[model samples]
Target: GITLSGGQRQRLAIARALAVDPRILILDDATASVDATTEARIRLGLREAMKGRTTLIIAHRLSTIALADEIVVLDDGRIAARGTHDDLLETSVVYRDIYEHGLLERQFADAVEARGGRQPLEAAS
Candidate 1:
């Protein structure tokens, strides 16, 4: 029996493809089911492995998409917007939605950090 999580299957597929040593790799909607941490690690590994090859990554996760040199957004099978991360974030609704969600998560984390270490309130003496 073969069992694999969606992300694992995707990564395995990628590894298998890489083993063939192709000049170009295309990943469509990869990393869709992996946890954030695991996804990040996989993305990092892909980045390293794609050093000189042309890689096409398709993902709904903004963090993954943001790493691309150029981002092409499609709507109804048409190119709605195309540019770098910052450019698309500024001009594309789809990109902006994803990027803003990521930003909000970061802001929440920063806010938690800014609160400093928490401590139990002292009882009346």
Candidate 2:
């Protein structure tokens, strides 16, 4: 057995999924262990790997949530709304406000720095 960091473990699991070549895959908070930048890259790759397959992804990160073909916004364990990302943004005021104030952006910037990539932008006043 090997000790793996949270991100590494998550990546390994994804790799395992890809190796098996499943027809339907369900990922619940799959990338939650990784930082935003790494999660972004992994998801970018998954989009192609998961093409034509049924992938039920459950994630809190807006970046991950936005990738879904259809999104269901849940509040207090109840369905508040259901639609595509853009549709929810337009119709659900609560969802829109949450996205605007979410930590996903900041976490993304942190991930970029961790990879020695672009620096995060300064916070708005």
Top candidate when judged by TM-score against the true structure: 2
In candidate 1, which residue pairs get closer than 3 Å at backbone N, Cα or C atoms, i.e. clash?
none
CA lDDT of 109 in candidate 1?
A: 59
**Looking at candidate 2, what is the lDDT of residue 59?**
80
Q: lDDT tens string, model 2, 9-90?
A: 8899889988999999988888999976798899899889889899988887778878688988888899998888899999
RMSD versus native structure for model 1: 5.8
Q: Candidates' TM-scores?
A: 0.74, 0.79
lDDT of 2 at 108: 81
Candidate 1 per-residue C-alpha lDDT over 5-109 given as tens digits, one digit per residue, 9 for 90 to 100: 887887788789889988998887778877677888988888888889998987777788787889998877898899999899788997787778888876765
Candidate 1 Cα outliers beyond 4 Å, as residue runs: 101-125
Question: Candidate 2: where is the Cα deviation over 4 Å?
Answer: 103-125
TM-score of 1: 0.74
User: What range of 10 consecutive residues in model 1 has the weakest lDDT sum?
Assistant: 116-125
Number of clashes in model 1?
Answer: 0
In order, candidate lDDTs are 0.80, 0.83
